[model samples]
Target chain A: MAYTISADGLRKRYGDVQAVDGVSFDVEEGEFFGILGPNGAGKTTALEIIEGLREADEGTVSVLGLPPWPRNSKLLPRIGVQLQASSFFERLTAREQLQTFASLYGVPARRADAMLEAVGLTAKAGERVEKLSGGQAQRLSIACALVHDPELVFLDEPTAALDPQARRNLWDVLREINTEGRTIVLTTHYMDEAESLCDRVAIMDAGRILRMGPPATLVRGLDSPARISVPSGVLPLDDARALPGAGEAADDGVSLVIETRDPSAVVAAMAARNALTGVQIHGATLEDVFLELTGREYRA
Target chain B: MSTWQSFRSLGRAMFLGFVRDKGALFFTILFPMMFLVIFGGVFGHQSTSKVEVVEIGAAPLIDQAVARDADLRKTLKVTRYETRAAALKKVEKGDADAAVEQRGGTLDVHYSAADQVKAGTAQGLLGSIVESANQAKSGVAPTYRLAAQQVEDDSLKAIQFFTPSLLGWALASAGVFGASQTLVSWRTKGILRRLRLSPAPIATVFAARVVVSVGVALVQLALFLAVAQLPFFGLKLQGSWWMAVPAVVAGVLAFLGIGMLIGAWAKSQETAQSVTQLVVLPMAFLGGSFFPLDASPGWMRTLSYIFPLRYLNEAMLNVMGRGLGPMSALPQIGVLLGVAVVASLLAMRLFRWDSA
Candidate 1:
């Protein structure tokens, strides 16, 4: 398969701090790839290096088979970038802002209106960007990026600081863009957003990637125990512990919980005892994998 | 993406932004036009007032001339003093505009320098009186005579000078302030990074900005000329006045370069604003925008040479105010273009895409 982006041993430093340390990754065509990390994890730095906004201290990056550094013009027309901070031309209306960007890429003016409609900002198209709410402004910025219809798109925390509804709405927009078979590389701190949207994710921290894989594959590799729980009083703590295949059991006020390698055996034992009322089975997720790998709570 | 398309789009957007900004409109166009109105009203149709002269020790020549010529009598209000020292002291104390005494064939005239206009009138009146007296004594027509005439139009008023000088001031402020503020704000706001990521060439982006700024400056020049030409102000455009167009373009480019240098160096809007003010205000005062440089002290006139606005004002005044030929503006244009190239190169060295 032809890779859309290939980065090798990327390293960047800012004074005393190593912003990106020996990071490497490859993205295939039409892939929705993500770099997931907390606020200080150097995800933005790594993304910037790949986007040609900054030079790396050490490493090589190729997008669409072309080097990005020193601003390769050929690659610019083929890729879209949405920065963490959304900035527009002064006092321009939403449509005008998109149209200006479109003109820069030699795209027709009609694409601006079409892109605005696609982003569901047609109603507010005539309003100045400053007047738009955060979500609307974010949408306008994304539309500007996509106005030229580049084959590859880079979004740096496009959904950060947004309300839940807005975030979900933006997720839909992003999914539709990806559905059009364009490769997308995203940097985000939201674990659920990464897990749901990215085909593969690189979990980073302290300027290093801890793991890189499909979310489900990474979670399954963890081999962590599942927790099965029922409403308190449904099963006595002692009986839960004595159940076959249950590694440990406890009653924590609201629920009687059992940790077991085989969730099916635990659930079967609970059902046999007529103690399956309100049973909830918790499986290993990407969050647990992050915790297990980092040996700390996932703050983001 | 063609460079022309990028230039057109960016230029159109910037021009729209400028026109839509009420504060910029007021400062760049209306403010200088207001100065023309105020200065024109004060000095446009001035009539010379009488000068007070102190006669020290028997100036028979002046006494006879004042008695004979009604014009001299109306212009000079003469008073007698006992001693030359007392008359000189009176002039020094500003109580009298001049002190005059006839010493043999030479008439001694001393005028206070505190008010140049009044002193000039007094000196001219007394000198003419002495010359006529010499002719009467000789009792023969003089062989040679000195002819004096103004190089500019006969109807030239203060409006002519104020229009071009004030217009130069407006263009300087607008170019510097506009370029610096735009650059710093764009850096701080991350718009510079956004533009960098676009397919448009960086050169194209700046070229568009330059084009827009020059276009706005031309509009300012036109508005200033139209307003000053109104019969109330009576500004007459003279020989090669059209040459002010090229002068304005060069001047704007020079100011824009300085502004960009400031913008590239300053990390914030406040810093850029204060620096532009520091550079512009002093330059305006020293550049003959507020007053004629000829009336300034020698040191100040020399100091004004360092400012690009001085060259701009001089060039425009040569063509528009003094009615000089187009060739008169060439040297100033060359200096302004040199400044533009040098400052722009330095600005390029300091330019940053992000405030960080």
Candidate 2:
């Protein structure tokens, strides 16, 4: 199978910080590949390296079988990129912005109208970019990126600052692009978004891929404990951790919650210890699996 | 896509961008026109008011004595102030030529440093008036002699005096280097980075910006010239259009290089603007935008020589004012070319791909 993106031992550093220290991955053609990580997990740094925006200090990266960098490469026009927080000329209309990008790619300007429509920004085609809502601007950005109908696309947090509805709308657009036999590589921190959008996901941390697989497979592999909630002040933190089958117990403002794989066993033991009264079981989510694998703390 | 095609596309975008930017139009074009109208209206064609001497006391004969001296009457419009103190106040304010007081047998003259030449002229006139009074009232004639010098040149015009500097400053004001700033900002916004991944070469984007900007700058130049040629001002273009055409093109390139250097060297738009001011402000002022300095000190003149605006101004002045040929402007042209080459090289060197 042909891979849309391939990298081996990619390494990049700025000053003393090893931003993308020796990362390697292959994204299959037409696959929606997602890079999921916490903030500063080197997701953006790694994406930038593959997109040809930054040079890798060591290792090789090939996008659609061509090196991306300052040197001339034929693969550039065949790829579309939606960068996080990218802006258009404030004075330019959405259609004009799209057309400009199309022209830069040496594509016909007629496609700009269609791209705008695809992104649901056709009604605001003549409106200046500065006047567009946050969602509208994002849609416009996406339209500009896709004006040339490229086969490979890179969207770095394409829906980062959008409202839920806008984000959903953008996701639908991305799906449509993917459905048309084009491959996509996106980086996002929203676990649900990554699960919903990506065919395969890579969980990154500290400039390295901690895990990579299909979302379902990755989630299933995690032996994360199901959470149990109890009334506030019901159990002390130490007593809960000491219980059999309990992994960790955390206190919510009004409730005590515990993580454990064998929820039933833990509940019975808690009942014997008089620690299960008023406790409730909740289903596991991607956040739980993420916290279990990456630790339940924020990293800058 | 070929490089030409990419540049063409970028050029179209830049032109559209410029057209849509109303604020830029207002500041670059309209604001400068307003300034020119206000300052030119106030100062242009106004004669110098150098000196004022108030003759006081026992001058009924002195009044008649002033009437006898045609040279004094022609040169000085002696106004009668309430007192010598009032005249002295006028001199202190740089409003008077001199104040003359005759108390007892002593004569006192008060004048300002600003009006030194006028003061001397006033003193000479006063002495002649006194002599004439002595001849008329006391029958004692005093001997004196005077010389006169005359010059005639029908070349000077108000527009020519203002245009060169105004053109340079206006072109430099919000243009030239502004393109680089815009590009850098686009990069910061991630738009340029996105563009970088596209088929278009980054060099094409730069070329397009220059093309559109140069075109707009030419339009502004034409507008300033048109405004200067209204019936009242009647600005004459004395030099061959050929002489000025190349210089204007050269001036654009030179300043564009300076602007590019600022844009490339500075990390942010704000820093670029500040740097642009550092180069533009002094060149506009000291290089002779607001006022021409024919009589300013040598050091000041020397400093002006180092500025591209100064050479541009001199070259333009020679062509527009003296009807000189292109060869007459070779030194200025050479300096402008040198500035352009050096600035372009520096800009290329300092140009950064990322905001960091």
Candidate 3:
């Protein structure tokens, strides 16, 4: 296992609050790793520690085979970061902003325009950053982070304040960035984005990673494998329990839900009787796994 | 990229950003001009009124002729005196505005040193009347002569003495307030934090800001000197005008260091604005930007020395207004350079990329 970033026993304290407490993880080369947590879960703090934006009270962290602490001069040029709610120079167009950042690494100006096109901001290259919509600005922010063409990129809630469509649009951009073989470590609380984008995730809460694995593996580890629902009017609640592989039957107003390990068979039976008008079989999700593992909701 | 190359790129970007900002541009170019128009219109030109003269002999003949004319009589009030000593006494005691004695065809004028401009005006008016009377008597070109004296230093005019200080005030506002607000906003907006994430040296970033401020201050000085050059003010650069260049640069950098300190201390925009106003207004007052601090209380004069604006103002006045050479301006320039060095070092020590 070749890892691009590895950390152990990281701890950071802000006044009396323990921001990143005894956390550790390793992200392999070219892997899209994610830290999934609600706000204030210390994910940002942990990510900042790795990015060298902050110091850990007690920890040993390495990035690209070198320590990231004390701000390694060699390490900095090899990584990119898009901080949460980032801001740019006032009235500076998106292209110029990227050029300025590129200059920091000695990258050519042409890369700035190219990076703009990469982020789907080609038409907006001349528009001032303040005029950009939230999604566009976020995309530009990511473009700035990647302008130097670093191998590892960190995005902290890249789609935090966007509409669902905009969020989806930004998700495609992130996936495209990863497709270019760059290792990306992003922090997000949205489970669907995590499941779709991240190769592996560390579900965090209260400064700790409770579970670390692929999304489906973690979800499948939940006690209930699937939940099947059909309208109660199709067949009264008591009769649905008699269906095969139905673990527990419950009526949830207008529908009867049956927990089942074999939803395919359950779904087929409902369809045979012309009772499949609204039959819905949902596999366990990361949210369910999070709730089952942490004994708390995924949001604050 | 090399550090210098990075610095140039960043500096160019910063300069563009500052100039393109309409509010910043307006304040940089227009705010100081406002003070100039207001103050210059009021104090640029001067004129004098009627004078009461004690004539020793009363035989200039033109005095009698002038007495016959309503306008001339209204302007010069001449009275006869028995003796020169008595007239001189009256003038000394401030009873008479001036005493005139015509001897060997050259009028010896004794004006009470109450006000130099008033005394000078009286002498010129009396001499002109004497010449007119003589010309009427001889049908020849009249002579211009009068012995004028004042026991005090009144060598400065209203316009020349205050304009340089006003220029310094403008630079201070543009450099100090401007830089402080910029640093605060960047920190509050996460711009500084984002820059920290990059490999760019912190000094390189701040160097760009410092360079831009110095450039703005220089432009401000040029604009003021041009305005000061108009015939209305009739200003002469008493010393090498080039001395003001170093003075303006050093002064702006010194105040920029102060601005950095303010930015370091102020955690938010409101706090920065309040602190900037508090520092700038009082410094302008005590540093003699508006009026001479010599008339201010003694302690205030002593306390004003603690602020860099005072040295900057005095330095500008020394070079451009006082027209003193670079060596003569050394004391003020030394203070400014010292401030630039020490304050900048302290500010660098205290400056932070984030409130956290």
For residues B1-356, what per-residue lDDT tens digits would candidate 3 score against the true structure? 57876788788778878878898887768887888767876776642245778878765554665757787776777788988898888788877788888776677889877767668878787777776766777976646655665422324556666678888888888887777888898898888888777788878988888888998888888888888778876666664768888888889888888888888878998998888889888998889899877678899999999888999888777767666667766788888889878877887788887877
lDDT string, candidate 2, B1-356, tens digits = 87787788778767777777777788778877776676556655554343355665444444565576665564666667766677777888867777766665456777778867777888887776666556666765656655654321344655667765677677766565566567567767766666677777777777777777778778877887788767555567774634765676677778888888777777777887677778888888888776786757778888888778887777776776556776877788788889989988998998766775
Candidate 1 residue lDDT tens string, A1-300: 658999999999999999999999999999999998777889999998999999999989999999999888899999999988888888889998998999999999899999999999999989988899889988988999999999999999999889999999999999999999999999987878988999999999889999999999999999999999888988888888999999988887998889999999888878888888788999988888877776685465
Q: Itemize residue pairs with steric clashes in candidate 1.
A: none
Q: Order the candidate numbers by TM-score, best to worst.
A: 3, 1, 2
lDDT string for model 1 (B1-356, tens) is: 77788889998888877887889899998888888899988888763356899999888888888899997776788899989889999999988999988788778889888988888978887888888887988999889887767655554567877888889899999999999999998899888999999989999889999999999999999888898899888888987999999999999999999999999999999999999999999999999899989889999999999999999999999999889899999999999999999999999999999986
Runs of candidate 2 with Cα error greater than 4 angstroms are A227-282, B47-153
Candidate 3 clashes between residue pairs 3 or more apart in a chain or in different chains: B238-B323, B239-B323
Between candidates 2 and 3, name the one with more favorable lDDT: 3
lDDT at A164, model 1: 95
Best by DockQ: 1
Q: How far is each candidate from the true structure, as Cα RMSD in Å?
A: 5.7, 7.3, 6.2
Lowest summed lDDT across 10 adjacent residues in model 1 chain B is found at: B148-157
The DockQ ranking, best first, is 1, 3, 2
Quantify how close model 2 is to the true structure by its C-alpha RMSD in Å.
Answer: 7.3
Best by TM-score: 3
Give per-residue CA lDDT, model 2, range A89-164, as digits (tens): 6578888888778888878889998898888888999998888988888878878778888888888888888899
lDDT of each: 0.90, 0.77, 0.83
The DockQ figures for the candidates are 0.60, 0.48, 0.59
